[model samples]
Target: MDLVGNLYLPEDFDANKKYKAIVGASPFPQVKEQVLGTYGPEMAKRGFVFLAFDYLGMGDSPALAGEFKQSRYMFRLIENTWDAVSYLGTLPYVEEIYGLGVCQGGSIIASAAVTDHRIKKLATVSGMMAADPFQWTDKDVAHQMIAAANISAQKIYETGEPDYVAPFGLNDDQSKEEFVSAAAYPAMAGESYDYYGRDGFRGPKAVENFSNMHIGDQAMQSLFSLCEHYADKIVQPTLVVYGQDAPTAICSTAFIDRLTNDPEVSAFGGFSHVDFYYKPEAVEKSADTVAAFFNK
Candidate 1:
């Protein structure tokens, strides 16, 4: 299957000179234009060829046969990351390829780098590195998520039509204020509404081919990827950056805790989780740090 992507090259990019490359994995349910779009250019400006792409069934990429759109299966994303690394290998000017993952993408790159030596270095900004705690924190909620996924999986098997659901609680019609007012999502995921909601700085409508919904069955596989568990296996030089005050800060901390190799941690006090998405200061800080780390 063909995967759609955008490659950001430095303004001074020369065909004759070899340059290091970075493959960026984006946040959950987010297209390449969302977080990656913001960082890809920044990294390129800092002297690396940055590649950002939509996984199968996301954005402009079509789903594989027997699969429906918005199917973000955990394992499939890793395979897609590998394919992206392979793509970088085809570029004559690329030297050592690196991986820069934001939010869920961080976990993805780390998982891929576990054995894929192609990715020489790794960096994650406000990463949702350990997903199980967020999904399995409450036993009842966990069962409910599983039951919903089971039902959706069964329906797809029988009907061949994908059942889509907003992974986040808010509806497309709902504004972030409304969601916050009603206390729709009390968990850390609620912070996401500020970015994914219709009123967000860059909502689904703002980014082409983006929707807040994903195949309902994705939860089954999504909840099972314990990236922190495999952190010890990842030997690449890694950098973990996030907002120290953000509730999701634990994700980076937890991930770093399990990393056998010493990782550079940048938990800034003023920034929040979503701040790294579009906030210029946060993005620049994170991007510059990542570029420096990869370059080092």
Candidate 2:
């Protein structure tokens, strides 16, 4: 299969010798430059060949406005990710494949591993696997996504272009809100959004496609459905990392708890989901845990 974005092979790469491989996926709307660019090279220095790529709709890949919809993008993420793994396995030096996912990409990797047996081990940073976003239990929040989807879709249908408001969480007026939204993180300050509100980063084309597309509902529905369908099938050795100070720590912990509590799944060792994303100490600790798990 044709692979997209970048693939970095270790300096010692040789067909005669086999080495462990690590595959990294970034957060949504975030290109490989944001996280993987920093982490991949470091892991490569550790004697592991690292591979990172942009999702179909983000970064160097094809734009979403013309060929893809939000729902299809989610499915494509899984397919493309699996493609990366398949490509890695074909390398002469690759002996085993490990997955590393960040934020939304974390959940994507988890969902992929559930169905693809090629993934031997898993690690997630700030991963979300809840029924919905942290506040979804509230009817207001549920309706908010539905309403936004409807509004965006209508706008796209009426006009050929999208209005292109900020993505979701980091609106221009975010400072004016009563509380700091989760989208305020420095890494996401310029490229994030809340599905319900208008305070994030989005390109004009994304905005137009979002409004014109029906995939929003399909993506949300898949997220919820996958938690029930694949959570039990994730039997590989797993490590989950999150930041205590990070806004999504609670949700990450809840997800880890659900995965570790199941008898069919608990056999895999687990980590505290809150200590892996941004906390300095937590990041180091989680990295150690991941190194140990992958080495095993």
Candidate 3:
């Protein structure tokens, strides 16, 4: 869909010679900058062209109404990503595209790589390959999320209208002061606002055609169901980096165990899910791991 992208070319890049390239996928609610910006340039410094793009309906890309079946939604996401990878292929100097995904982006690239041979290698940082409601300390919330999405999906099926709900946003009746106190993951929610809310870390991108705050129920359902059916299909060499302290660390465990290909897993000390994408030490370590893996 003519997605917007920033291609970080290696220093002294030659147009005639084929070079390995990496496609960087953004974490949920983030534009290319939130996570990809943190590592894309660094990877380029390590001598590879890095391409980071906004998905369709995100950043500066064309917008689609946010309502569809889970599989269809995921299919669109996969196609849009391959669109970026395909663009890389069009470049005369590009060869052997690799994928680097952060958080949910990690899940996405993993799904995409299942059949897309173009992705010769893959790496994910704190990627959520699967969700188990029982894993959360507050299992009720986990079940609530699934129930809520299914309820919304039922509404869509009956009414033929999208249920516009901010999965994490406080309801209109809820007080902003209660954001931190009542939030499921108070710290993550607060940081999310800081990074993407008005005048926040990535507010500029948030303001520009980036409407990830509200997701359709079907989309949420699809996201929840991701990797349950296809994770093992990833045969390409893969690397998964997780934060030892991250809440979502368990999500990657299943992928590592189930991935038929021997997936390399690394855990960085003193890092949380957010830290893996934002903290300098974690980002550097993961990026180095990714560069080394790709170069191999």
Candidate 4:
């Protein structure tokens, strides 16, 4: 099967010299090209093959048009991500396999790592473990998400077409809501303004009328459900990294603590999540931490 994202091979890769592979999963609303491409080559130089790809309905991947709901689509993306890992594992040059997820991707990786024995190490950057994405707020966003999912699913059932809209805040030029310094804010790429000049980065959108997709409440509930089911099964070496200054730093730290506290996790470590993603000193620290963890 043709993979949906880009894959980078280590510079010293050789069929005779087996090397470890690292799969990178981008956060929701982000293409693999953006997140994976950002650090893949650097990781490759460290002797790890990196894989990154878009989710089912985003970026260059096959758009789900109207076949499934958000919950279902989430499963498909997880499956696709596993497929990527399986494919990498099959390579003659691959000696071991590891996973790294950002934001929502982190949750996906955590779930997958529990069930897939091929994954030996796991890492999450700004991972969430809350019962709902919006549970931190007083908003009735969960109801909105369920309602929107139902409405969009019905629309697709009737019209066989999807109506896309802004997923979170209004489009950059159309919104006056001041962006706040919060976990969700930075996890959503640290403000749209910063991405304005980037070549392909753009604002978030709800495809197939999935406008209420990322409601905090629903996300939290779904993730906790997964954690409840699989947290006890995760046997891999785990590392949860978060940034103290990043918007979601506290949440990420809480998430990591929860995972480490779980009886299923064999060994685990924590890091500054933000430092790994954007800052130079932080990235270096994160890279060293990750390299050492994986190398062990």
Write down the lDDT of every candidate, Cα atoms only. Answer: 0.87, 0.59, 0.73, 0.59
Q: Candidate 1: deviation at residue 176, Å?
A: 2.9
183-207 per-residue lDDT for model 1 (tens digits) = 7455444567768887776686687
lDDT of 3 by residue, 67-107 (tens): 43112255566788888888988888887899998877887
Candidates, ranked, lDDT? 1, 3, 2, 4
Best by TM-score: 1
lDDT of 2: 0.59
Worst 10 residues of 3 by lDDT: 65-74
Residue-wise lDDT of candidate 2 within 164-213, one digit each (tens)?
A: 44334333334424223344454333223222123322322323322312
After the best TM-score superposition of candidate 4, give how far the Cα of residue 289 lies from its true spot, in angstroms. Answer: 1.7
Sliding window of 10 residues with minimal summed lDDT for model 2: 261-270
lDDT string for model 4 (47-111, tens) is 78888776665556655543432232557657887888888878888889999886677777877
Candidate 1: where is the Cα deviation over 4 Å? 184-191
| Full-model lDDT, candidate 1 | 0.87
Runs in model 2 deviating more than 4 A are: 1-3, 68-72, 131-135, 157-163, 171-225, 260-282
lDDT of 4: 0.59
C-alpha positional error of residue 236 in candidate 3 after TM-score superposition, expressed in Å: 0.7
